[model samples]
Target chain A: MSKKLVEAMADLEEDAVLAEVKALKAQNVPALDIIAYLQEGMSIVGKRFEEKEYFLSELIMSAEIFNEASQLLGGGMGGAGSSKYGTFVMGTIYDDIHDIGKNIVTTVMSSNGFNVIDLGVDVPTAKYVEAIKQYKPKVIGISCLLTTAFDNIKECIQTLEKEGLRKDIKILIGGGPVDEATCKYVGADHVCKNAQETVEYSKKYMGV
Target chain B: MKTNKELYNERLTRIKKAIALEKPDKTPFAPMMDSFCARHMGYTLAQFCFDVELSNKIMIDSIKDLGEVDAASGTSSFAGGMGLIFMCRVKLPGRELPENALWQLDEQELMKPEDYDTIISKGWQAFSNEYVATRMNVDFELLGKTGAFAPIADQRMREAGYPVYGGGVVSLPVDYLSGGRTMAKFMMDIKRMPEKVTEVMDIIMKNNIETMKAGLKAAVDPIDVFIAMARGCPDFYSTKIWEKFVWRYLKEVTETCIEEGIAADFHIDANWERGLDYFKDFPKGTCVFETDGMTDIYKVKEKLGDIMCIKGDVQAGKLTLGTPEEVYNYSTRLIRDMGPGFILAGGCSIPPNAKVENVRAMVAAAAGK
Candidate 1:
C-alpha cells in the first residue's frame, strides 16, 4: 500500500497516473482514497517547481500529467464527492502585449481546477473592471512582460478603487519583468513565486 | 590622379590613421541612419522599421544628409518578425501590435518535440509545403508580406520616465530558474550541480548557433547586417556571465559570419566601459561594435585600434533634446575622436519619436561641412 501511494505520487507520466487512478475504481476505492492519492502528487510537483528542483519544462510536464489524472477524478466523481474551487482572471495591461508567463499560470490554474478567464493582451483597465463585474471573481491575476505596461496593474487597482470594487477582489501578479516589489508597488494583494506556487497559492486563496 | 573609390577609400584611410592617433586628412566624418531625419524628409518611424523600400531610400538619403563621411550606416529591421506577437488591424493608418497575456497558451512547460518542429518550420519551409509560392510573379507582390518574429512587446521601466518601446525575451523564470533563481540557488547549483547550469547554457548556445546559422545563410542585404548580435555590454551582463555564457558562443556565431564573408556588427546599447579586452578574440574581420550613449568611443578607438571598427556613440536622449548646432558640434567632436575606425550613429535604437531636423544637421556635421 505504501508502495502504491509512492508509485501514484512519484509517477510523472500523465496517462499512467490517470490509468492508476481509474483502475482504483475497479478495486472499489473510496473518494478519500483517490483524493489523497492525487493531492500527494500535486504537492510533489508544486514543491519541485517552487524549490527550484524543477525547470519550467519539468513543471509544465508534471502539470500536464496532473491534468490527465484530474480528468479521471473529475469525471468519476459521484455527486456528493465534489471538489470545491476558485476563479482567476488573468491578462497583460493595455499597450503591452506579453503573455508567456501569465499563460503558463492560467494553464496550471485551469488544469488544477480553478475557473480562469484570460483577458488577452493589451487589456486596458476598463476591460478588467468589466470582467470583474461579470465574473465577480475573488482573484484577479495580471501578467506583464514589459516595464512600460507596469502602470496597467496600478491603473486597474485605481479603477477598481473608483468603482468601490478594490476592497473585494484580490490582485495577483507574476511575469518576467515584474517581482514581489512590483506586486506591492503596483498594489496587488499577492504574487506567486512561480508556476507551482501559483497553483498552491491559488488553491489556498481560492479555498479549494 | 586617385580614382573616386581610391579617393573615398584614401580619405577613409586618413581618418582611420588619425583614429589610430596617427596623422591623417583632418578627421573622419560619417552619419548614422535615422528615422526622424527620414520623417522630416517625410517618412514615418513605422514605415522605417518595416518597408525596406523606404528604409533603403532613407539609407541613401543619409549619404546626402551627412557629407563625405567614412563608413555610412544605420539600423533598419527589413526582416525581423518571429516569436514577437503582434495583431494587425487593416484600418486607416493601420496598426499591428503584440497581443496581451490572454493570447498565450505557453503553460511554462514542455512543448513536446513535435511543437518545436511546427514552430521552427513556420516560415518559407512550411509555407512552401502548404501553399505553393503562387505569389512569385504578380500574385506575390499583390499579397502584402506577413512575417513571424519573436514578439516585441513595449515597456516603460520603473526608472524610465515614460513608456518606451523595448522587447527581447524577459519574464521567463522557469526558463531561467530551472537553473537557479536567487543568488543562493546559483551558488548551490555551482557547488552541487555544475553540469545542470552548463547543460542549460549549452542548450541555449546550441539554439543560438542554429538560429544564427540560418541567419548567416539567409542571403539578404539588410540581413547581411547582424543587429544586437552584441551581447555582454557589461552593464546588463556581468563579466562572469559574459565570459561563461556569452563570449564563446558569440565568438562561434561571429566566426561563422566571418567565414561566410558577410558583414556583421555588434550593437551594444549600454556603456561597456573599458572592457575592450573582452571582445579581443571575437570573430575578426571588418567587425564593427555599435554603441549608444556615453560609450568612450575615443578610448574604444585606442583599445580595439583598427582591430575592429567602432560604429556609433551619439547619445540619443541628448541628441533629441539638444539643438541642431549642438548636434553638429557633438558630431564633429565624435568624428575627431572616432576618426576612421568608427561609424557615426545614434548611441542606440533611435527613438521612434525624435526630432527630424536635428538629426539632419548632425548628419551634415559628420560629412565634414
Candidate 2:
C-alpha cells in the first residue's frame, strides 16, 4: 500500500470519516481514493466477522460508521463522471420499519459507493417501481422485522416482475423475518445475514 | 361499642391484610392497564402515546368500559428511543411497523465525551423536535399517571443489534443521566479500553445516595414493579451484568421503596428463561416480575412463592387473533394455574389492533364475576 493508502487505512481504522476526509483533502486524495480505503476497511470487518472476531452488533456499528463518512462526503468527492460504485434503493419494506438493520445496510451500501436511496418504512410496492423508474437503481434491497408480514416480499418482487422490471432489478432480502426459505420463496437474488454480508452479497449479485 | 381509634385501625389492618395475600374484602383485582386495549375505547395510538390529555381520556374510557380493571397505568418506554425508527412506518405492507424495533446508533460514530455532552444538550431538543404522531387510538392523561414515557433516552443499544434481552434499573434520575453518558459510549470504550470496565459501572451509580432520595419523591405503587419488568427481558448482558451494572442500584431503589412503604414490580418478559435465579434474590413482595411466551410463570410457585407478584399469560397475538373462547380459556387457565398470586396480562403489550372482545373475555375469565 502506498503512503496515501496507509494513511487512509489508518483513518478508516479510527472510524472517523470526517477526519479521514480532512486527511484525504489535505493529501489531495480524491473521493474515489477514500471510497477504496473504506471498501478495504469493510472487507477487513467482513473477514473478522467470518473469523468470529466480530458480532452482529459490531457489524452494524461498522456499517453505520461507513454511512456517516459517506454522508459527509456527499456527492462532491467522486471528481467527474458517475459514482464510482452504483445506485441502490433500500428500505425496511412495506409495513415493517425496523431501521437498525436497514440503516446498517444503507450505510454499507453507501460506504461501498452506492448511492442508496432509502425510501423509509412501510413503503408501498408502487414506490419501489416509481423510484426505479426515477433513479434506475442498480438493485433493490427490501428489509423487514415483522414475522407477520414475511409474505409481503413476494408482493414486492412480483410487482417488479409484473412491471417487466424484475430482470433489471436485483432484489436482496434480509432482516429478522428473512430465512433461507424466505430468501428462496420471494425470489430474492441474495440473502444477507448482516450489514457486511449485505454489502458483500450485493457486490457478488451485481458482479462488481 | 367499639372505640373510634380501634375501628380506624381495624379497617386499615383489613386493607393491609388483603394486600399481603392473607385475606381482605374479597379479592383485589388490580389488573395492570393494557394500552393495546385502549384502542377499543376510540383513541389513536399516537394520541394515546404522546399527548397526556388524550391518553388520560382513553384510560378513563377503557377503565369505564371494562369496569373491572383496578389500576390506571399504561405502557413503559420512557427511556427507550426505539420509537424513532417508527418514523419509517411508511415502508411496510399494510404500512405496519415492527414492534419494539430500536435505533442502533453506530458505535464508531459515538461522540467524544465533549461532543456527546453537546449532543446530549441538543439531543433532548432533537428528541422533542423529532416527535411524530402515530395516530394510534388511545388517551394521554391516563398515560402520564401510569408512566407512559416521552423518549428521554434512546436506549436502543440493548434491544437492537445486540441479539439479547436487556435489564435497565437505576436508583436516581441523576444517576440515570450519568448512566446515559456511560451507555452511549459503551461499545467504543469496551473495545478501546477494555480494562476500564469497572469504572464504567462506577460512573453508572456514583450518586446513588441522592438518586435514592429522589426515588422517594417519584413513588407510585413503586419503581420496583417496573424493575420486575426489566428482570424478564433477555439481552441485559446476562445475570452477571445485572449484578455488576445494576443490582446494587436496584437494591437501593428497592430498599428505598421498602423504606417509603411503596410497592414495586419487575418485568423482563420474552427472554426470561434463566431469570428464575434472579427472581430468587428479590426481597419477597417488594416487587412483582412479569414474563412472556418463552417463560413458565408457574416455576415461581416453587422457587419465588410469596417473593413477588408474577404476572402475564395472554399472548399479545392470541388476544388479537384468537377467538373470545380462546382468550377466555387462556386467561382462566393462567389465573387458576398461577393461582391468586400472579397478575393476568398479555405476555407483552396487547397490540393496537387487538380485538376488544378478547380483552373483555380475559377480564371476565380472570375475575369470573
Candidate 3:
C-alpha cells in the first residue's frame, strides 16, 4: 500500500494517491510515515525534472497532490515535524509583487524538506532583516521580476550587511530578468534559474 | 534630403522584406520599448501610464534618438489595458504604488472554477465584460482613452519615419485563464478538470479569433498581429499537456493570422526551445518568432531560419547591467550572423534602466557603424 502511494504520487495520480493515503490511514499508518512516502515520491518527481522528463507543471502538480494527501493524513505537512534541512527565508523584493516564481521556489523548497518562510510579495528590506533574525536560515532567496526592483534588492542586501546578518546566510536571487549580472548588482551569493536550482543550492549549502 | 514620408516607406520596406525572409539593404532594428521610453524622456512611470499622447511622443522621440532604427514593435501603451490582456487587476504606479514605480499585475483567484460554466453559458465576451467590471476594477474610462489614442500613436510613428510592427495584440485562452485564476490554480484545473477547461477555452478562442479578425480588418495598413504566448511556454508543461492546452490554441490563432493575410508576431517569453520545432509547421515568411532572450536565438536560427523571420533577443540583463561595448558587440554579432531574415530587437522590451548609450550601440550595430 505504501509503495502504491509513493508510485501514485510520483505519477501524479491525484485520486489514486488520495485513495491510498486514506487506505493507509485506515490501516493506522503514522502521519509521519505517510509524509515520508510522499516525500519519496517528490524525490522521484524532482529527479524527473532534472532529467527533463518532467517540467514545472509536473512539479506543481506533485506539490499540490502532496499537500492534498497530507491534508488527508489529519495533520498537514506543516505538523509533520522540523525538516532535516534548515529553514529557508524568501520573498519578492520591495516594489515587485510578482509571486509565481517566489511561490514555486518556496513550494519546491518545502517539499524538498526545507522549512520555508515566505514573506510574501513586495517585501520590504526590513522584512528580510527580521526574517533572518528570526528564522536564522542558512540561505535566503530574493526574487524580482521588474528591473526597477534591482536597486531595492541592492538596498535589502546592504541592510542585511548593515544589520550584521549578512555574514552567516547565503543570499540568492532569481526571476525573469535576473542573471549573473543581477546577482553581482544585488550582492547576492548566487542566481537560480529556476526553483529546482534553489532546492539544489539550499541543499548543497545545508550539506544534506 | 529624403522626406519623412520617403523614409517611412523605406523603413517599412526593410521591415516587410525581413518578415518575408528576404535580404534587406540592412538589418532592421525594431526594438520594443515602453517604460524605457518614459525613463529616457525623464517622465515618471505614472505619467507614461496615464497620458497616452505623452507616451506616444516619448516612444517616437526615443526611437528617433536611437539613430537608424527601421521600426518599433509598439508605439503606445496604457496601464489599464494590461488588466484586460492578463485578465487580472493591475496596480498602477502613483495609485497603489509610488509615483515612479513600475505598474504590476495583482494576480488573484478572481475567476472561480464555476466561472468556466458562466463562460460556456454566457460566452466569453459577455462573461468577461461582467467579470472585468465587477471583479477586475478596471477603469473603463482609461481603457476608452487609450483605445482612442492608439491610432494616433501609430500615425505619429509613421510620420516620424518608423513603421510600427504589431497591428494588435491577441492572447491564448490558456494565458487568459492562467492570469484570471492565477497560474497555480489554473494548472491544478488543467489536471482536475481538463475537459471543462478545454470547453471554456474553445468558447474563448472562437470569440478571440473573431475579435482579432475584426481588428485586423479595421486596422489601417495592418502588418503583423502580436500574439502574446509567454504563459504557455512549454517549459511550464509536459509535452502532452502543452500540446493539448497551449499549442492547439496557439496553432489555431497563428493559422487564423495566416488565413487573414497578416503575419503573426509571436511575442514568446521565457524559454521555448523545447517547442521550437512546433513552429516548423507554419509556412515560410508567414510568421515572426520574437523571443525574450531566454530561448537560445542561435538555435532558433538553426531550426526556423528558413521558415520564419526571427526578431529579438538582446537580453534585459545585458541592457541594464552591461556596457555599451558589450551591447554593441552582441548586436553586431547578431546582425552579422542572423541577418537577411533577421530584425534586431531587445529580447522583449528594453528594461527601463537600460543605458542610453547601450541602446544607441544596438542601433549603431544595425547601422553597421
Candidate 4:
C-alpha cells in the first residue's frame, strides 16, 4: 500500500493522486492493489464525512478522483465482484425522473465499497423486483423527489413483500420530500437524510 | 361581507406587516402550491401542465376551498417555465411520461465547461435564449402561450380576493450552472477552475440583479422576489466553499432586495441548520427565511425570530400521508410558537397528492379555528 496515494486521495489532491497512480503503475504495482489503496482513501473520505469535517462536496470530489485514478489502472473497478461490501440496489421510484439524489447515493455507495446497481430514474416496480431477484442485494435504496411518488414506493414495498423478497433485505428511502412519516407510509425500513447516512446504514446492515 | 378588493388590501397589509416583523392581527396563510391545487380541483396533472388558464382556475378554486387564505405564492404555473428555473430540460406529464405523472426535471450535463466562457462573453440573456431554444427541447408556441397568460392569471387571482406574494423568481448563479452542468460536474468545476467559475458567477449575478430591479420597477404590486437556492444550501458544501460560492451571492442578492424596497423570499430546500447564522447580518424585517422540513423550523425561529419573517414548513410528508388532525396540530403549533412574524406555508410546494382536508386544516389553523 502506498501511504502517499492513500493520503493524496483522502486529502482530495487531484494532481498528487493522479501522479502517484502513474508512479505506482510505472513501478509495476498490481491493478488490484492500486484499487485497494484508492478504496482505502475513499474510506478515509467517508470518515471525514461522518465527522462533519467534509461534506457532500468533498465526497463528490473524492469519488471523481478515485474514478480518474481507477481509469489509469485500465478500468477494472467497474463490477460488483471486486467490492469488499455486498451489493446495493438503488433507483428513483416510478414517475419520479429526478436522479440527482439517486446518483449521489449510488456514487457514494460505490466509493464506499458497495457494488451499486443503479436502476436509473423513473424505474417501475417490476424493474426493481427483477433487479432484486437477479442481484439479491442485501440493501436497496429508493429515491423520490416528488410527493406524488409516495404511493408508488408503498406499492413497490408491498410487491416485494408479496414476492417473499422483503424479509431478506433492508429497504431505505430518501429524497427531498421524504421524512419519517414517509418512511412509515411507504413501509421503508429507514429514511436516509443524506448520502452519508445511506452509507452508514448500509454498512451497519452488511456488518462491515 | 367585505368586497374582494377590500379583502385583498387587508391581506396585503397583513403580509407586509409580518414581513416588517410587526405583529398582524392574525398569522397569514400564503401557501406556495401548484400541482396540489390541480389535484385538489379534480384536474389531472396533464391538464394542469397543458392548459395555463385551467391551472389558474384550479389555483383560484383550490384557494377558495381552503378558506381564509391571505395570499398565494403563485396562482398559475407553466411546465415550460421550469426549464428557465432549473436551466435544464423538463419531461412534461403528457409529453414524456404517463398523462397523469408529475413533471420532472431531466438534469444532465447539458452545459459544458466551455459554456462558462460563452456565458461570460455573450451575457446570460443571449446564451440562455439560445440554450433554451436549441438544448431544452421546449415548444416555442407553448412557451409563448404561457408567457402571455401569466399576467392574466395573476390578475384573476387578485380579482378573486388573494394577493400574490412573490412578483417574480430569481436564482443564484450556482443553481442555474449546477442544474445545467449537473451538480457533480459543477462541484468538480468549482474545484478545477475556481477563478473562472467566480468570474462567470459575477457576470450572471449582475445580469440577474438588473432583471430583478427592472421587474420590481415594472410591477404594480411587487411585494417580494422569490430567490430559489436549494442546490446551493450549505448542507452540500463545507463552510469555506459555501461562504465563497453560495453565501456571498446570497448576501448580495438580499442586499439588493433591501435597497430596492422589496422583500427577498428565500426558497431554501434541504437542511440549512449550519448556515442560519449567516442570515443574521441582513437587516431586520428585510427577508423571509422559507424552509422545507429538512431544516429544523424551530431552530430558525430560535435564531432569527426577531430578525426576519419565517414562512413555512408544513412538511410534504405530513400533508400527504398524515391525517388532517396531525396537520392541524402541527400547523397550529407552528403558528403558536413561531408567529408574530410567521406566514404559514408548505415546506416548499405542497405535494400534489396531499389530502384536501389536510390543507384545509392548515388554513383553519392560521384562521385560529
What TM-score does the predicted chain A of each candidate obtain versus native chain A? 0.63, 0.68, 0.90, 0.89
For candidate 4, write residues B50-79 as lDDT tens digits.
888888999999998888999987867777
Q: Candidate 1's error at B185, in angstroms?
A: 28
The regions of model 3 sitting more than 4 angstroms off are: A20-30, A72-80
Chain B alone vs. reference chain B, TM-score for every model:
0.58, 0.63, 0.98, 0.98
DockQ of candidate 3, scored on C-alphas against the true complex (2 decimals): 0.76
Off by over 4 Å in 1: A1-11, A25-36, A72-88, A95-97, A106-127, A130-139, A146-155, A168-208, B1-51, B55-255, B258-369
Candidates ranked by DockQ: 4, 3, 2, 1
Question: Please, what's the RMSD in Å of model 3?
Answer: 1.8
Provide TM-scores for the models. 0.48, 0.55, 0.96, 0.97
Summarize candidate 3's per-residue lDDT along B152-259 as a digit string, tens digits.
Answer: 888888888887787767889988999999998899999999999999999989988999988887776677999988699998899999999999999999999999
Candidate 2 lDDT over residue span A22-41, tens digit each: 66767776766676666666
lDDT of 2 at B138: 19
- Quote the lDDT for A37 in model 1: 69
**Lowest summed lDDT window (length 10), candidate 4 chain A:** A73-82
Model 4, which residues run further than 4 Å from truth?
none
lDDT of each: 0.51, 0.51, 0.88, 0.89
Interface RMSD of each: 11.4, 7.3, 1.3, 1.3
lDDT of 3 at A27: 89
Specify the highest-TM-score model's number: 4
Question: Which ranking of candidates, highest TM-score first?
Answer: 4, 3, 2, 1
Worst 10 residues of 4 chain B by lDDT: B75-84
